[model samples]
Target: MPPPPPSVAGGGRCILSFAALRDRCFSHRFLAAGLRPLAVQLPVGGREDPHTTVHMWVPASPPRNPLLLLHGFGASATWQWYPYLRPLIAAGFDPIVPDLLFFGNSCTRLPDRSDIFQARSIKAAMDAIGVTRFGLVGVSYGGFVGYRMAEMYPDAVEKVAMVCAGVCLEEKDLAEGLFPVAGVEEAAALLVPRRPDEVRRLVRLTFVRPPLIMPSCFLWDYIKVMGSDHMLEKTELLYALISGRQLSTLPKLSQKTLIVWGEQDKVFPMELAHRLKRHLEGNSRLVVINNAGHAVNLEKPQEVCKSIIEFFQEPAYEASNEEKV
Candidate 1:
């Protein structure tokens, strides 16, 4: 899982390079390289007049079933899916990528409590946009939110997919060995990388098998978009959220669930996926993408997307034939 060498795929700016700290500027440029931007409003604590700002990316499609994309900790909705938005649109799914409150361009201020509260705002956003009963896709921390959604509103979520989800783990099991705690700067520092090299190292640590390398530019951009302070705050908040929680409840989720993980994923490792599968009931499946790492979506979006389409399509298509009678 060592850092990957730089890769340029016919673009204005090359991928972020970790060659030198001075090349960090490219990170900013990379973050701004999106096709479209969306502005959304979510009511704050049940009030209509005052709403929190959430940035989004809505794909152009013929209004197929909605797909809610949730990002990992310290990531905005856009960054989680990144360059994959355009391709998803081309495939017939309406991808709704939203900044989950505190991360990215949404609200920078910490929510004062937990991301659990942010889920309510997400539901509000869905209601505002006239979307209900859609597929849910969450990565890392966002995966937890997806789990909560499926658990709370079984009827509203048609399918649930978790990619490299952040699990409630023992303190000793983490890379940093300390659970993030809000208001504690040190713990936050441990979770995020301040330098480009550190970012590469982190990516390596999380992705173990396929030798997937995060171009230094990717790390550089990641670090710049998520400044040190913001990274720390998110880390603290996330740590507090799952520090002592039990993850056993998630497997009991009734929605058609798919636990997708990269075989080489160092973060939530493939073994964890196996552990999770044991707890899950109903129509649930575990898929391991070969030669991929923790950032499975980024490393292999098409493969992941294909699995998603097939997984969701089967049940609905079967039901339609049944109704034809």
Candidate 2:
């Protein structure tokens, strides 16, 4: 809870990072929903990633039917996962929401930024928390990490739900005009916005209908608080993500999978969702939310939450290769 970064302190004006206060409010809501904050140290990471700190919002009581919620690349999980926490808890699943490395209170001295590494970090944190097996749901960037977790630790990961993750994307997709952005540099800039306009552009791309008015001051406050830290590391993560990725190389998960997408998603597009379904293991199913864009979870929280709950409640998919709104 400090003033905005130096970038926003010009003109001798006083500005505070409102995002901190917002996070505090979210924390209280989480506490009210029977969850508390816990920071776990990751020592399993080799020399470069020693003692990486991963902060998690976990159940105060022992978790029953635990579900790990991984957030997107930009904001903290507290902001993104706040809406679903109460509902998930009420549905008899302990929602273990964790801030991915470089977001919120999670950080590391390590240079590694691959989704595989991120998956490993989160797994180590789960191990420390005494969770042997759990369901996992990841959104956007978190979906990528969740996929890796399911692939790497099939025994520990019972099921997976991914929101707007471009799992079918290949390195050549960008060059072949798959995304609105020309290339990785532009993609990274919007994903990790530094300027107010970049933040607006990101919103426009992520949402089907963005807010009518977003003040410059507030956007600057958001950048300083939510996006100013570990910028280089985050950019590197994007590059590392798309470097040599291909559908053939991407491992299909053995666990049951749920792929959710915004019907009007500009970020990953609906085409990718169908492609993911056709290519991923036959046990997977896809759900498309109408009138929603890339940020489907935020725009269609109730629908997304309902789908997740129903999917997890069942032991296995009743039908395979399904796509429903």
Candidate 3:
């Protein structure tokens, strides 16, 4: 029989278990406020549904072309790809930023394990939005999604880019420093920050390099609506990747691919970029940003944007070869 449940702080109404609550506190310590509600989704699951929190941001005057932007782990779509979206729009490209289901504000309180579900939901969202052929860009965790997308639907993606993405966890130990939890209990224990100051401190250490100050009221607001209270979902996703059990599958990526990495990034690191470059089956290029960490898109937006633009504008080799002949 299941062991007697521990005392729940918010009464039986709270769907989260004691272990879930503990893990949420521990794991959520690094998630920043500016990156909540990754995007919006349709009315699919009820309050209990797992894919509720996914959202999308469409820029004004969306060009005939559309660019999809996926965010990093535990970050909202807007926060993760903010640099690219605005500039991409200004440059006459339609940019779409969608928060994956579990992380941001698409909905709260998903089942303890929902990465696969999130992936399917994201695909559904793209279909719903009528995204046919478009460029795909993913940062960090989002890069994993982009890689999978390129692998799964090679014909659909015009180009692919991974910015400081965490891929190949099974083949390598890139994510060694991302999560600090030793076990399930230790994971849950990080969900609740004792005070707002603690939250800020954790954010600075894990996410922001120079530390972007969030308003005090905003911190309190985030704590109130805090979803993703269970850390295991994320852990399970990582475990699946690390164990080589589950990740977006790519047989032979034919799309043009660009990989970007922050030279100083500790999470995925420069080696990850190198390894991914070696693995991709399509034409690919690598760009390393100096003095930047995992959040290069945010820390050095212009540089990142410049790289993207140059990549996009550079004519495909086939096109150039045909012209030359």
Listed in order, each prediction's TM-score against the native is 0.74, 0.92, 0.67
Off by over 4 Å in 1: 1-36, 49-51, 59-62, 108-110, 168-191, 207-222, 226-229, 248-251, 316-325
In the range 1-325, model 1's lDDT, one tens digit per residue, is: 1223344433244453333333233223233433345567665556552446666655433246678889875445544565555555566567777777666666534355466666666776777767877888888778877777777778888888877775544444453443223333443453466876655555555544323444455555546645433554566565666555555534467776777888776666566666566566335677778878777777777888777766666664221110000
Clashing pairs in 2: none
Ranking by TM-score: 2, 1, 3
> How accurate locally is residue 236 in candidate 3, as Cα lDDT from 0 to 100?
61
lDDT to native, each model: 0.61, 0.84, 0.57
- Candidate that would win on TM-score: 2
Can you write out model 3's per-residue Cα lDDT over 1-325, one digit (the tens) per residue? 0011232233223333433454354334223211222344544544324445466655433237777788765444544554465466566567777766555555445453434455566776677667767888887767777777776776777888778875744332323443344433333333334345645654553343543545444444344444333344655655544454322453446787778888777545566677666666436777888877766777777988887776676666431110000
**Candidate 3 accuracy as TM-score:** 0.67
Task: Please give the ranking of all candidate structures by lDDT, highest first, separated by commas.
Answer: 2, 1, 3
Task: Report the alpha-carbon TM-score of model 2 versus the true structure.
Answer: 0.92
Determine which window of 10 residues in candidate 3 has minimal summed lDDT. 1-10
All predictions: root-mean-square deviation over Cα? 7.1, 4.0, 10.7
Candidate 2: tens digits of C-alpha lDDT, residues 209-314: 7776666777777777677988898899899998888888887788888889999999898888888888765778888899999988888889999999999998
Clashing residue pair totals per candidate (backbone < 3 A): 8, 0, 23
